[model samples]
Each structure stands twice: as structure tokens, then as C-alpha cells.
Target: MTTTNAAEATTATAAARATGASAATDVLIVGAGPTGLTLACTLARAGAAVRIIDKSREFHRASRGKGLNQRSREFFHDLGVEAEAAASGIEHITLRKYRDGVAIADTVTFADRTPTPGMPYASGLIMPQWRTEEILRDKLAEYGVAPEPGCELAGFTQSADGVVATLADGRRIEAAYLVGCDGGHSPVRKALGVGFEGSTDAEECMVVGDVRVDGLDPAYWHQWFDEDAAVLLCPFRGSAHWQLQGIPERDADGRPAAPTLESFQRLVDRCSRDAGIRLSDPTWFSIYRINVRMADRFRVGRVFLAGDAAHVHSIAGGLGMNTGIQDAFNLGWKLAHVVLGRAAPGLLDTYEEERLPVAAWTLNLTDERLRAVVEGVKEAGVGTEAVITDDVTTLGVGYGWSSLAWGGAKAGGRAPDAPCRNGRLFDVFAGPHFTLLGFGRGSAAALAEAGEKCAGLLRTHLIEDGDDPGGHARRAYGVEGDGLVLVRPDNHIALSAGADRGAEVVDRLLRLGR
Candidate 1:
């Protein structure tokens, strides 16, 4: 909650210099949302000097992004905030269909699945976006880096070596790299002249907000659908409120109407047909026009973009915030490597090379899913969770096509979580270093040599065939025999190979890091 006013910012700048804080920080992150906060925490954890700022004067209060997909859950686990997130959230809720205020069929969004030894978080969680941000900000505070509120990025110019950023309050700061985690109307992207090419759906719009309602059961996500309009109320976990989404009739100009409490009440009355469900004590509201867009490029010189600044899409799959979280996670470690001098600048290019396509794919996938849901509602009088597909979990996301991927079938994919020794594979890969999972006795010598060669930059773990009685690690990683899987700081496999070539794969990967 540090305030960055004109005088305070100037005094702080002077104090930083007096205390021998670098004239140029390693990273300057704009926007204190999930993407920027996640990146700040990652870089700070990796011992990089980072400064994160937000245009707003206070932390956001709205539960704008609520769903945390399975991939994000795993990523948060690595960041050491999974338990808090899970505790503060609900795992899943059934969507109960209602017509004219009468309940009908109930559909569960996520199928029931038990946690396997390899996959700990088999399903997504539902928590308010404000809670998620709170968790991330708390973790960032632990690193002694609180986001500077009321500090806006006015303008910035970058050179071959560093970035010089000017704040709106007339303070200037220098940084080795700059990142924009700002929203879709990103000033940074506009300043960089990057093309955010896509279309905004003018025909369809949603009124979304959080409100307290009476006479509605809180156990299920209640939905009321008629021919032309629909209303959905999903109870927010750990709160007395529910998130409300509805489609209202357009104005005379055939435009999506603005959101207001009165309008919301009217829509509810129309959809519920006098069901007696009353919405009150509104806290937040917004009229969202679906925008499917992606930045043509993710980086320009020493400056880069992540989150909504880089891409935006429909909320059908609840991928907006989750994708942003993943973007920050992917960029965090690579930026740390370059900042800490453990990797070449070329490593940074892989950020866009790996993530840009994912964003593009998400845009199309969500667009189609949104269309499908709309069509289903029009055809069947109810929309199912069929749009919440396997891809929504994001576990299948990979970088197999990237140049960094090498060796075996699992290369460039997420390193699966599995039982190892007394703990798990993720426990071994929890830190800021690369991990080499050596399986079976034949790989012992190669693992030892690779570990010695990579020393501080890599951690090698030998998972003997009998380490876990169920052989979950081997099965999870698809290691049928003696093998080695080299995992990057981001927990994606960089190299996977047979025991004989484990050391060679490690050497080659390290050379790329150099």
C-alpha cells in the first residue's frame, strides 16, 4: 500500500540512489494486475531488482476474473501460493438451469476426477479475482517489493542497453527491461505502435457484476433463460455475493446497452418472470463487449508486453486472466535468466516465440466457444459446460515447435508433477534453477556429470525405479526406460533423452543459456 505521490516519489528516488540501489533496476513492470504482480514476484524471487507500478491509486476490488484453471493452479503451486488460493476458493459448482424461475436440469462444469500421483490439481478453482490479486500481492510483499500505487507510466524510451521511463508525476526511472501488463487499452502497446489486430463483437455484449441476492439457492450456479435473453448468477466463494451475467435487449440504435443496477433488475425480472429473486447492494458492474485481439509482437527492444496488453479475447472459457497468469509465468523465468546473466539475450526472444501462438490459439478457441454457447442457448433453451474443454485447463499447452525444445517426445511440454523420493517432482523443481530428472541406474553417471557441469544453474534428481512404489514418476514423464528430462526454470521440459545422451543434452541446453 505504498503511495507514490510527486514529492514522495522524488524523495524515494533520491533515497534509492543514496542507498546504492541501482540507477537502473533490472525490470520495471507497469500494471499491478495479476500478470504484472506474478512477473514481479517471480523476478524478485530470482534475486532480480524489480519495481512494479499501477496507474490506479488502490488495489482493484472487483472480482473481474474468477476462474483459476488447472494449469494456473499448478503454476501457483510452484509459486508457493496454491494452498492459500485453494483454501480461499471453491473447486467447482454445478450449473442449475431454470426456465421461468423453475429449476430444471443441473450440469456440472468440470467432470469429477481424483488426483493422480502425477497430477495434483485435477480441476480448476473458483475464487474472486480480487482474492487472487491479494494472494499475489501478499507474496510480492514478502520479497520486500510492494507495488507503487498512483504511479503511472507516462512515457518511455528504450535504447540498446536499457529503458528510461518517465512517470506522470515528472519522475524518471531507468530499467534494464520494461514490461506492460496493462489492460487491453494498453498505452504501452499503443506507444510501441504494435498492432493489436482483431475485431470487437458489436452485436453481443454482457452485463457482468457482483451483487447480493435473496431467494436464490447458493449451492448451484443458477441460470434463467428465455428466447432472447439469459441471466446467470454464480455464488462467489467465501462471500455473500454472487457474480451476475446477463444479456439484455439492445437499445433503439441496436447497440449493447450500458450496465446499471436498474437495468440489471429489469433484466432479472424479465428473465425470472417474477420469480421473487431480488438483487441488491451492488458492488461492481461492467458492460463488456467481446474483443478478440492479439498483439502482433510481444517485445520491442528491451521492452515487452504480457497479459491483456498483449492479447485479449472472449471470456467464454474464462481464459482471460488465466492466460495472463501463464504469460507472466512463462516470461518471468526467461527474463530472470537474462537479467541474472545466466542466459543470453536470445533467450528472451523465446518468450514471444512460445507464448504468441498460445495467445492466438486462445483467441480463436474462446471465440468459437463463445459462439457455441450462444448457439446452444438459442437452440436448446440452455447452455451446457461443453465449452469448458480439456484445453481450458491449459495443461496441454506446449512449446514443442520452439527452437529450445530438444531430445524426446516430451520435450517442450510441461514437466508433469509426480511422486519423487519422499516428496514430488514439483518439490525438486520448486526453485529458480533448471531441473534434470534422471531415471534408473544407467543414468546415474550422466546425471552426476551434468549436475556438476551445470552446478548453480541446474538441480539434478535421481529417481530410482523403486523410489516410488507405484512408479508414478516414470509413468507421468513417459519414461519407459532409463532417461533424463531437463526442465527449465519455468517447469517446461527443455531436453528429454535416453540415459546414454543425458549429459550431452544438458551440455547443449546450457550452451544455449550461455
Candidate 2:
């Protein structure tokens, strides 16, 4: 991290030497975590010039955020990394509870469900955050763009036309837009003077880290809980390591103890006296205090915020990282469209309009879940399973009320996957283009005309009602009769209408984008 005074001096010097050359890229993204990396890959795949930077000297290797929900699985599939991510992950394991070294009960965190044609990934997968980041980084590398490590965003100024950003080492970067995917303490958000309003619970804190432990079964997530303390050890996929989480003892001054090997051992000893678990090879550690916060606004002029920069919440439901990934997915195509002049600049406003409410809702949901866990532990001697429900999977999130949503059936919802003639509905919606789906034979002409009108911007598919006996796509999309559905680049339903109004709906959506 650079000193504030040094950063200010560098920014001043860089601004004083501004030149008339065109910006180096269309978008400059700070923080190379999942959010920034996903956005970079999305934009670069769409032929937008993007540069991603991070202040960290090296890539993180910890199991920071381990739970990938169903919605995130669909996102990875669209990004073409689903196979790799699933290969590197394990299904959510059964959680085994122990009290005083005596096995009490076992339960699955996420309920099992059969995969439907309309929902390919019906369950969540557990992969370390490091693995997810590696996959996204590899995807970005395919576009010849890698995050510049150790490059700090010292300061930046956004004008009506572009943004001038100064790095800690005095390198000046010019971009048409800047995005702060940096974590909770985002430099870009600070520079933009965005208000982050929330409360941090100093009384609630936990120690989290990765370590190699012996004498513990790797099949199930082992958890030991008592009245005042708790310890959980879950095997991290793709490695001989376990992610350890526990309530740390407080110091003499009543502050939460610092996360160290000794503190972790003490926690284990207190929670599991006779489990015989021997912890060693400490890889990473952090004392995490619960913070619930959201940025007052996600955009400021030509600069914007995503991921933890825009909102942060309790990790009770594993919403932090997944929400950030969704934020990047939502922003990527919009940014690309505006940069390529395929859409009006106002299209960027929809990023915040669609995402901010989702963030707010997630914050409240996690807070409620956190309260449930705390209360359940206090009253019932264990956390309730209610914390991990279908809502945690994030499959129900959508933009139903946004201005971009139109039509009568399933409009403004996530476009579900279903078996198509060639592959699946997702396969048709893949890539950086919109999709127009005609649900029955009567809508063929409308689909063809819309495809011709939107040429490179859209791809059209016609699935007759008799094509599949199950009628999965029609049922999933709520198409009662011959209807047309337009899916946005982010795989959300933009418009759905009867066969007669299909072309009109397409024209109105294109005009809005224009």
C-alpha cells in the first residue's frame, strides 16, 4: 500500500503532465479479484480494450470464498469455464456435528435436487476462491490481458470525456471509463467520495484460514460447537488442506484475538478437546469481523464500482463473492456496448439500476441469516439449517422492475436453460450477443426479421412446440402459446411477447439500447 501523501504527490505530478494522446484502453479496472477479472474477460471477449490492475504483490492462494451457488455455476458455464470449475470442485459435503468429541448429528448444507432441462446446475459446488480466480484469470489470459500485480491505484480524476488514473509508481493511465472492483476498502470508491453506509459488529468476529490437519475425516465438514465457542473444518477441494473457521478468544482488552497458528490451536482445543486434530502448515489466516455495507451510488461520472467496492455483507450465506461476480457480469456487456457505440451511454445507468437493489436485498438477507445463526447458537446450542436455503443459491434473483424489462411472460427474469435442437437454451444464449427465441412455429417470421434487424447484435432461434415433448423451455419461460423471448447478453429476459408483437418488442428494445 502507498502512503496517502506519496499517492497525492504522484497524482498531482501525473495530472500536470497530461498529454493529448488517446486513452490507452476503453476501460481500466482496479483489483484483480473475481469481480475485476470477470469484467475484464467479459469486455475483452467482446473486443473491448481493458486493463486490470491490483495492488497486491501476488495472487491470493487462500480458500477465502468457497461456496459457488447455482446461479454462479450458470455464469461460469456462460464464460466457458464451467467444466474446469466443476472439475476442480466438489459437491457440497454433509455437515457432521460433534459435541465434546462425540458425533451428534449429520446434515447436508444444501438439499440435493435433480437437474432439470431448464436448470442444469440445480445444486451448488464447493471450490476454493483461489481456484475460481485462477480459472477467471486463465480466461482473461486468452485475450492477452493479465492483471498487473503490485500496481496500486494511487489516485484518479474523471472528466466528461475520460479518466486519468495515477499509479503508486507514478505511471499515468488514461481510459474512457474506470471501475473499482477493489474490496471493501476501495481506493476508487474513496476517490469518488461515495458514501459507504453500514455498521460493523465489533462483538461478532471469527478466525478463518487454511491449514493442513491430520486425524480429521475429509469426507464431511466437521463442526464442533459449545455454548461460548465453535470450530469448523471443511476439506478444501483439489488439495490436502482444510478451511478452518472458529470463534477466536478475546484479548485482555476485550478485542478479538489476532488470527495465528497458536490462536487457532487454542480454539480447536477449546471446541474439540478429544478430537485429536493436529493443525500445521498454516497457509493463510484472517480475523474477520461482520460488516454490512453498501455504496450510496455505484457510479460517479465515468467511474463505477463493483463487487466489494459497491457492497459487502456477512458471509453467513456466502453471498459476498457470488454477488460480486454477478455485478461484473451485469456491468461487462453494458460497458462493452457503450464503448463500442452499439448502445447509448445511458445504458450504463442500468448497471446500477439493476444491481444496486440486488445488493441491498442481499445485504438484508445475509444480515437476517447472520442473526438467525447467532440466535440459533444461543438458544438451540447450534446454528439452524435454515441459513442454507434455496434463496442462498441466488437462482431467484432478477431485474423484474427495471426499465429494460418488457412484455407479458417471464420478462425481466433470468433466462432458464432447456434442451434445444442443437444443445441447450444456454448454448444458444452463449457469447457476447443477444438471443431471440421463438417458442412455436407461428413466430418464425418475427424471429427471422428481428435477427436481420439486429444482425450482429442478436442471434435468433426457433423451437417448435413439438420439438421437445417435455416443453421445458416454454414452461420455464412462461410462454403459453406462440411467443417470442429476447434474452440480453447477460442471459436475462429483456422482452417477451406474442408472435404478432415480437418484431415490435425487438424494435423497442433496440431503440432503448440506441
Candidate 3:
């Protein structure tokens, strides 16, 4: 309060600047999985001084989650790594679900649509977590930020202005915001002492392995369900290995004891019935129990939580990692603005309000899926409801409770997909940034104005391909003739109205982004 105290504070600030670049980071993210890495890239691209740390020494070898949804695929496209991933090991397709001895649920196929809006990508693909991480790491590296592995968070104090985290080695970082992408057993979550409310399925155990299977259909992910056992098989195109998920028991000592081919054989025989083929030595294997749960809240003052730190759920929809990715998408831009003084702290509240219910619904739906599979209820057809809810793949997700008010044409529910010309070829969603789609003459001129006004913050696309306007696209965006739609950084519709309200659209999008 006195001159002496002010001078002391100034000196401390100056000294901090001298050591480690002395920056109170705009965002400090913990964990380096797909979610954290994606957040790092997105935040760094937004020009925020971001720091990311993880407790793991290296990327893990085990295969955890595998399904990459259509929405996520589109997101990867925006990041410019989808093609690389497609070349690596990921197959662009969905799965077929079966039960007992019959194919009850045939997989629904999704085709590639235009770059207009809805999800801005095609149908989902099946890929391993390891490869997914590899793509994300490459993207982050492109942005000149790498994950600080082997660095763990010990504790933190959240003041009104910032979060201070003490590292495992006794270093502290004062960050404007801290988002925990750490897994289920997050040290940050424990520090907050918030309860993770849900039940663990202890009665039924699960066995998973990546094995080399010869002469099996590599095109589709196969599932078999019997009264006694269930088996899930997915092909790994890179190594010619099949990632297997089954029900297996553990030893009395609580050790894995589940690496043998015998356990896998039983599941195969019970479900497949046709024992013409055999499953031999595995490349990887493990056994464990799973739970369906979520955290009560996703925030605590300056310390916020995302990904597994915020919620954990059954992988029925392969949503664990995907949900975490969505958390990062929602939180990244808001953090950028808050640190840059463009938005108030209240903007962060929407993270929990938007994602918590989604997590809860996901957990509940996944549990229902497991129960249906175990109880032989899929035969009745009511069980498939649990399979995919809200397309939590991030496509069906929307910013329903947005804080911005661009009345004439603000963001609505889900964005739609439409075709656009990229000069080279047809383009899909104008993603990785806010995209504006316009119709009618002079639409492109208006979009050009909006683009220049917020060039770095938003991307504008003028679709002049057809005369009738995009059918499904028009309905999804609620635009009729001459109109404009504003998509957010994450590809959700921020504002969807006619191009006549172009000025209002630009104002709302820029302010909301701030």
C-alpha cells in the first residue's frame, strides 16, 4: 500500500522477468494427451503464452480409446493433420454392432459433405489413441510448442487473478488460468477436493489386447455378444494387429495375469461360434475394471478443469478422449480472451454448464449400453439408444447457453455442412477458424468485408456453387436467400442469419471471441 511496498512489488516483477522469461502465462495446461495437446496448439495459435506439463516420461504404449468421430475428424482436418493421419493407420469408417448370433445393429454410414457447417467433416473413423496423439503432437510442434513431459503438478493456489502451481521439482508458475487435462486420478482434482460422483462396474471385468490376427476382415470393426462373454475386435492397419476387447478375469493377487490367448479364445468361441480361425500371441494385453462417472463441477476460481480432470465415462461411444478434446475446444478461446483482457472471467462458467451435462449424459448412456449388452436387451432394439447419444463426437454439440447476444443472427444449435470452392478443388467446412457462408450476389463482397475486419480471428467463405441454395444446409443454418452464418473457432455456429446483417454478425463474433 505504501511507496516501499509498491517498489518491492515492482522489483519482484522485474526479477521474475529475468528468470525463465518471467511470464505469467495466459494459460497453463496439465497433461499431454490428445485433449491437452490440442488445447496447447489451439491456445498457442490464438497467440496466448501457454505452458503444458505432464507426469508421463513418454507416450504410453497401451491402447486405450480408438474411435475418432466425424466431428473430431473435421477438427483434425482444420488442424491440417487429418490427411497425415489418414495416411498413417486410421481408416475412415464406422462400425457394425452385433449381438448373440445375429447382426442386430448395422452401422450407419456417413458420407463426406460440403465445408458449409454441420461438423464440417465426414463420418467417424476408427483409430488407436497412440496414432491420435502422434498427429496432435505434430500439430503442436508446428506451432513451436512441445509438451513438457515428466513434469508433474504438486499443488496450486488460485487467487482472484491467477493460478500458481508448484511443480514436482519445486518450481512454480503463475498463470492467468490453469486447465487440468490430467486423467481420472488428477492431482489437481484431488487438490480441489471435489467429489467424482458415479458408480464403478466392479462385478464385470474387461480384457483388452492388440493381437496379430490372420485372415480376418480388416475392413470392419467386429463385435460378438453371447450370454456368457462379449468380444470386440478392431483392425490396426499399421502393424496388421487387431485390437481386442473382451471380458476376462484377473488373478487373486490383483496382478494382470491376463495376457494368455486362452482367455481371448473363450470369448471368441462364445461369440463367434464359428471356430475356423484362432487367436495366437498378442502384441499387447491388459485387464481392468471400468466405471461410469463424472465430476460435480469443471471449475474452481482461476483453476479450471477439462478432459479426464473434469469427467470420466464408459468408452461405449469411444468418447473419453473425444470429450476431453471438446473440453479443450470450449476452454481454449475463452482463456485467450480472459488473459488478453478481452472478456470477463464469467465467460468461463459456460464451460461447465455446456460440458458437464454432456458428460453426465455420456456416462449414463454408456452405462446403459453395457447393461444392454450384458442383459441381452439389444435383441429388443431399445438398447441401441445407448450406443451413440447426441453424436457427442463434437458434431452434434452446440453452445446453447452462449453469453453473446447478436440478436439479428447469433449462433444457433448445430452447424450444417455445405460445399464450397477452394480454387484448387471443392472444400469442406471453413474450419480452424470462424467461417462465414454467404449466398446471392454481393454476398461474397459482404463476406470479404467481414473477413478483412476480423481476418485473423475469423474465416469467411462465400458459397456460389448452386442456384437453389444448399438444401439441408439451409435448414440446418436457418438461412433462406441472402444470408451469412458465423462459425466459431471450434466449428460450432456462433451466428447464423442472413448476409443482410453482416455488420451485426461481425460485431457479435469478434466481441464473443474476445
The backbone clash count of each candidate, in order, is 0, 0, 15
Whole-model lDDT per candidate: 0.84, 0.84, 0.67
- Whole-model alpha-carbon lDDT for candidate 1: 0.84
* Cand. 1 TM to true fold: 0.94
Candidate 3 lDDT over 179-238, as tens digits, reads 888888877777777688877766666888877776566776777666555677778657
Q: For model 1, how does the per-residue alpha-carbon lDDT over 46-88 read when each residue is reduced to its tens digit? A: 9888999998998877889988999999889989999999998
TM-score per prediction, in order, is 0.94, 0.94, 0.81
Candidate 3, after superposition: displacement of residue 428 in Å?
8.8
Greater-TM-score candidate between 1 and 3: 1
After TM-score superposition, the amount by which residue 199's alpha carbon in candidate 3 deviates from its true location, in angstroms, is 1.2
Error of 1 at 52 (Å): 0.5
Error of 1 at 140 (Å): 0.7
Q: In model 2, what lDDT does residue 374 have?
A: 78
For all the candidates, what are their Cα RMSDs to the real structure?
4.9, 4.4, 5.7
